[model samples]
Target chain A: DVKVTQSSRYLVKRTGEKVFLECVQDMDHENMFWYRQDPGLGLRLIYFSYDVKMKEKGDIPEGYSVSREKKERFSLILESASTNQTSMYLCASSYGELREQYFGPGTRLTVT
Target chain B: AQSVTQLDSQVPVFEEAPVELRCNYSSSVSVYLFWYVQYPNQGLQLLLKYLSGSTLVKGINGFEAEFNKSQTSFHLRKPSVHISDTAEYFCAVRPGSNMLTFGGGTRLMVKP
Candidate 1:
């Protein structure tokens, strides 16, 4: 089974603070995605990486960025965290296009 | 572009009763459909997916969904639900791109 693990399950940060959320997948999948889930709005894609050092902005990418320094690791960075940035962050990895993505335990961020 | 819509925002049902969660999508070409369940404070898990062939897809926890091409819908169903089945269900659609568009989600609340 593919196992995706996140660095933190819960986090709290003050406004304007920079935050980093890390995700690692054991299966070495090529595609990695970051999403923020909010009430009623569901999961909205924030960023995705198809290869190391390559990233694409998803539907909601403002105030967020991503880095993929290695094949097994992907990181989400918030340049300046705001209260609006507080939400559940999910990380997913897939081997190829049109394949099912395996998700890591989400990180619930609280920006106060 | 593709989009998904979950008709019901929340469905409350008694334990051991049958339940159906409606999901509809709009796409101009062929697409893949998926149903994912998110337990409390956890990441999303793939329940099932419809890529091709058989329209009826069975997934974990005794859940199933049928893909209706004509109606452009993939609705999840369970013969009988347990309290453990209570969670937030998301319907996603993958068009020709590598990214997936998720629905607003439906919260399933199972009662005793």
Candidate 2:
């Protein structure tokens, strides 16, 4: 089974603090993605990386940045946490040929 | 750019009742379609995918989706649902590359 693991299942951050969410995949997939899920809006992409050190913005990338220093690791950074940024964050990875994405257990962040 | 639209926000069905969750996509090129299910407080799991060949594709947990190129729709269906099937279903489309555009999820509530 493909395994995608996130650093934290739940996190609480204070306003104006920096937050980091980590994701790792064991399948050696080349593509990694970060998304935030809200109640009715579903999941919206924040950022994606096709290769190490290369990142692309998704639909909702504002106030978020991503890092891909290694093939197996992808990190999402909230430069300054705000209450509006509270949501369930998800990470996914997929192999090149097959577009099927495997997801991690998600990190629910609460900013207060 | 590719986009997905899920027609229903919620679909409540009784146990053993048939159900259908509609999804439609808009894209300029050929696309890959997928259905993902998410249980409460968990990440998304791949239920089925339509890459090529046969239009009808079956997935895990007795779920299936048919890809309709003419109508630009990929609707998920189940002959009978169980209480365990209650979850949020997301329909996603990949237009050309690894990036996937997701639709607003349809929450499936199975009541006894």
Candidate 3:
């Protein structure tokens, strides 16, 4: 079974604080993604990395940035967290050309 | 650009009854379709996917989805649902790009 693990299941942060969400996949997948899931709105892609140090912007990438310095790790960074940034963050990875993504448990971020 | 639309926001069904969650997509080129289930406080899990050959794809937990190219729809179905089947369902479409476009999502509530 493919395993994707997130750093935290729940996190609370004050406004203007920097927040980092980490994800690690054991499957040696080449594609990793970060998404924010809101009620009714479903999941919106925040950022994705096709290869190490390579990134692409998604639909809602304004308030979020991502890093993939290593093949197995992907990190989501909130430069300065805000109340509106609170949501369920998910990390996923897929092997090259397969396009079937496996997801981590998710991190519920609460920006106060 | 590819976009997905889940026609129903929520579907309530009695235990052991049939259920269906509707999804549709709009894209200029060929696309891949997927259905994912997200339990409470958990990340999304792949239920089924339609890449090419077959139109009807079966997934775990006795769930299945049929891809209708002419209608541009991929609707999920289950002959009978259980309490454990309650969750949010998301339909996603991937065009030529590596990124995926997800639908608004449909919440399935199974009553006893």
Q: Please tell me which predicted candidate would have the highest lDDT against the true structure.
A: 1
lDDT of 1 by residue, A16-112 (tens): 9999999999997999999999888888999999999999999999999899999999999999999999999999999889889999989999999
Which docking class does model 1 fall in? Answer: high
| Better TM-score candidate (1, 2) | 1
lDDT of 3 at A22: 100
Residue B61, model 1, lDDT:
93
Q: Enumerate the candidates' DockQ scores in order.
A: 0.83, 0.73, 0.77
Q: What TM-score against the true fold does each predicted structure earn?
A: 0.97, 0.96, 0.97
User: Candidate 1: global Cα-lDDT?
Assistant: 0.95
Please identify which of the two predictions, 2 or 3, would achieve the higher DockQ against the true structure: 3
Q: Give per-residue lDDT, candidate 1, residue A105.
A: 89
DockQ winner, 1 or 2: 1
**What is the C-alpha lDDT profile of model 2 across A22-104, one tens digit per residue?**
99999889999999998778789999998999999999999999999999999999999999999999999998856688999
lDDT of 3 by residue, A9-83 (tens): 999999999999999999999999999988888889999898999999988999888889999999999999999
User: What's the best-to-worst order under DockQ?
Assistant: 1, 3, 2
